[model samples]
Target: MVNLVVTLRKKSQGIWRSSFVRSVAVVASGTAGAQAVTIAFAPLITRLYGPEAYGVQGAFISIMSVAAPIGALAYPISVVLPRRDEEALGLLRLSAYISFFIAALIAVGLWLGGEAVISLLEIESISTLIYLLPVAVLFAAWKQMAERWLIRKKAFGVIARSALANSGFLNSARALAGFVYPSGAVLIVLATVAEVLHALLMLIGIRKRTTIDLSESSEVSTSNVIELAHRHRDFPLYRAPQNTINAASKSLPVLMLATFFGPSTAGFYMLSQMVMGMPSTLVGKAVSDVFYPRITEAAHNGENLSRHILRATGSLAAIGIVPFAIVIFFGPWMFSLVFGEEWSMAGEYARWLALFFFFNFINKPSNAAVPVLGIQRGLLFYEILSTGGKVVGFLLGFYWLNSDIWAVAIFSVVGVIAYSGVMLWVYLCAVRWDRDKKAV
Candidate 1:
């Protein structure tokens, strides 16, 4: 502990000393800190809002989650690709512009065809609140774009702070607001507030870090932005659909559960996903955000990245084993104790999800290879397969097995297999990239 403190102090003094470690620490610390707050408030949140209300909130989130990724046209993802900040800035503007149009389209569609949408999705509970999807998409997509710009700048510290601020404000708003309105609609409003706040914080961070980033001094124009868009066109063409499907697949358990079993089941599933997914989403995300830029740098300079990939996978796998084991073993008792008797079912779901999350954690950082190595078309195929896997897993469980537990269990099993395939594919791609770079 004493040595660790000294090391951290040195890190704080010289953040550039070890870029990868520093970046990971900043992002991981921020994510873990924010998630800790969410966990700390879970009891109060669960008690105040209850499972059914959470289910309602979860369904709406599921809808926006799918839309937000596509709304940005996935351009922000390639922001790290451009060597010049000018090109990056152009991509940023392009992504933001697309996001605005997507949000507007969603709002207009809802205004004109809200009833049709409700009937089509068989979701009447959130019909009144469906209009808020546009707001959610707009704010969330813009936040993603802003965050991507920071990532391009290697501003992990800024990104980390933003994560803490964003999650804290968002979750707090949801928790505190539950006491007042205590409806699912209130959660949506609070979420919109949090997303807008997070985006503003990121914008402020960008401005404070470098006036040049905020400046038109870069001379990015409509044609320049269009050129960059055409250059990374595959991102929007291939990656957007892939990401949307992946997100929609992730959202399905909630929607399917709510539609088939009821809101309480979906709520239980959402809580289960939240609790089990924390380590992967929090820490793996930190590693991935850092790794994406680092790998880009490596590929740019013809450097080998296999060692780095192996080290990351090993470290995440090691860190994940213990916590996930505990979740799988004692999930039910802990959920009952922490979240109340109503959430005990969520623990069962958590146990079933443990293997899937473990694989997912190992896979998250490696996912950068698709973008970095330009193997997105293949990745798109994988996404389709995995999305089908998830949907089919749930459907099989629901219809064939006639058991919710079986449904989730099959989904988790399929997820583990799908993630393992993706991890292997990325490893192969990284290896091939290294070999080809060396041969040159």
Candidate 2:
């Protein structure tokens, strides 16, 4: 009895000091667990699939990427901004309905239009993986929604478990597919199934807690749903473009590389992103999941969300910078050693892209605070400008001018600096407005 009380006290104390930290830990642990499983199976995957297989997988993921911005329909932000539990619940249900309908449409479209998409992307040469696109998109959308729900509830533990299970199973399945199928397309399909199953498990895990029993509670009214969607219209209207531009800008480089060069060259660029960007993507997401809701609440209360934002940024930078730096410095050797000589060029790409990863770690979460202040429109405009800059840079580097790898590297740096500047400027403007309003 004494020991149990002591244990509970420690847990409570930790939560009191930093609820966000606890939340991040739950998601991080799950992510780490998932990555651990993948890393353990990495050698097998590398040996079996090769860089060309990875290239095909990247194409599949890239095509399916639309599932996020479209299926979400800006509903994820609704989870953070609403003031009342009822309002939030209404938003949740409405968003889920919209998301499900969109998911179905997207799945069907991807299934039917896989050929056209492949041909458009000039990936018809490797059309064997075309059929896997829709199935993967469906599961990806499902997992994305489920993860958002968990993030909304601060159900960090559930998130961690689901992510771990999903990552482990998906990677392990990929390994098995590699051994048995050898066709990169088949391996990609199996990987998608594993991911879908993982996401479903997470949905099941959270449904018990998140579901409102109509029998025990007030009935959900049609008016409530309409009002919920209407109230949160800012999300799809303003926030969605910001997210879309950001994703588009990030995605443009690889697509350009693939178009200008080929899958083999694109694979080299992607391998770098996969390794160096992992920490930024995972850590930034975990921190954003915790900070966005809390900071939004703080903003609503006229509290200084700036300090919290800085603290979150600082924490991520501190932890992520070292790993990022190591990769930047040693990426070439690491790629060669880990993935074999064929992938040695992957290191150069990693070294080049690591700069983006570093800035992205700072840029991503800091950018989230903008939406909390309800400036998603302004954010969208800024992302559009920045994205345009990135597109120009990619074209100059990858196509219209220089196709040399070193020129691509130099242009990428210029693009990162330009985009990073825009991100920081926006963050400053948002913070200033937030502070002024809080003072008023």
Candidate 3:
């Protein structure tokens, strides 16, 4: 009992004092501020655009979300892999080159069969936005590359600043356009503009804050970049597919709902995702981005990762529990009041999705551990199962069950279970790393 009490106390003390927690708080603060700005404009955006218009926007987002990961081929994740900035620079260039190549492929595909694809989603309203899909994917890739480089430097403040600017610019533009009478494609374009701005801001932030001797980077030849890409071939080979599965899984509700129900159903789904995603990204991504570097150092130096993981997991659970509890109970009421009655169904979606989001909240900080632990294949396999489970859940609800709410509930349950599995895998990886070190 005494040992248990002491351990608990130590963890409590450590949580308050850890550099990792401080960095998370800094980034979360900025992200919260950014999200607050975006949320503030939601009432206006929703009122002006309506659910059907948002449904069209949601369809555009779903397509771009899937393609974005493919465009970068998961190379941005390699920014932190190389110890030397020169090598990291090579990785960044490699990511850019791959992004352009992928974008060109998307452009060709769109030119050939864009309208037919949009017709399938029942979002023919935004068929014109299909051409912008490649542009959106390219911007997504660039934003990720810049953001990963900032993470390598532990520049949470810079990231925070850019995040705020990006949100402000994005929502402000959205509101301004909506006031002038906007179409779904216009709204999608405005969102894409925001991504482009964020990437540019990240570039400027890095330039002003972190100095890189491009002279060394310049010495790195095209061959060196190719070698760097090959060195991390697992990223494109394994991680890219994993990311695509992840993206597709997240967008499934929107895509599937639109196919069977209508644009309005997808709009409600999109709103729920928008609301939940704001808070989730604020903390989940902030925690994950900050957690990565510290864990990498611990794994490489043979330092024990158990305590760090324990503190993070406990703290994150506590952080997530209260808000999600409220969401599960009063999500519909909150959505109707905040976004108007048209979005009440969005709140219903949120109630079930809360369980899934909570699990994911706890999972995000540990996700980077997969690559560090050399268990990309394990994660990949689990991702396939998870995605498959989600699809089954959707199909069960859509066909046999014949209810959209049932489908969402089932999908959320599958996600909660799958993400729990992910958390367990990460813990085992840490334990295995420790065991190996002891044997050495």
The whole-model lDDT of each prediction reads: 0.85, 0.70, 0.87
Candidate 3 differs from the real structure by a C-alpha RMSD in angstroms, to one decimal, of 2.6
lDDT of 2 by residue, 156-242 (tens): 788778778778677866777677876657655776677679768877877665654434214557787887778778778877767
Give candidate 3's whole-model lDDT: 0.87
Per-residue lDDT, model 3, residue 178, is 88
Query: In model 1, which runs have C-alpha deviations exceeding 4 angstroms?
Result: 1-17, 119-125, 211-213
Candidate 3 lDDT by residue in tens digits, 1-440 = 99999999998899769788789888998899999998899998899888888888888888888888888899899798777888998888888888999999999999999978888998777677779888888988999998899899998899999999989998888888888976787788887887789889998998888766657667779989888888999988898999999999999999899889988899999999888776578898898898888888887788888666766787789988999999999999999999999899999999999998888888876786777877787888899999999999999999999999999999999999999888887898888888889999
For 279-326, candidate 1 gives per-residue lDDT tens digits of: 986889998888998888888887877767877899899889999999
lDDT assessment of candidate 1: 0.85
Candidate ranking under lDDT, highest first, comes to 3, 1, 2
After superposition, candidate 3 runs with Cα above 4 Å error: 1-17
RMSD of candidates 1 onward, in order: 3.2, 4.8, 2.6
| Clash pairs (backbone) in predicted model 1 | none
Q: Cα lDDT of model 2 overall?
A: 0.70
Q: TM-score for every candidate vs. truth?
A: 0.94, 0.88, 0.95
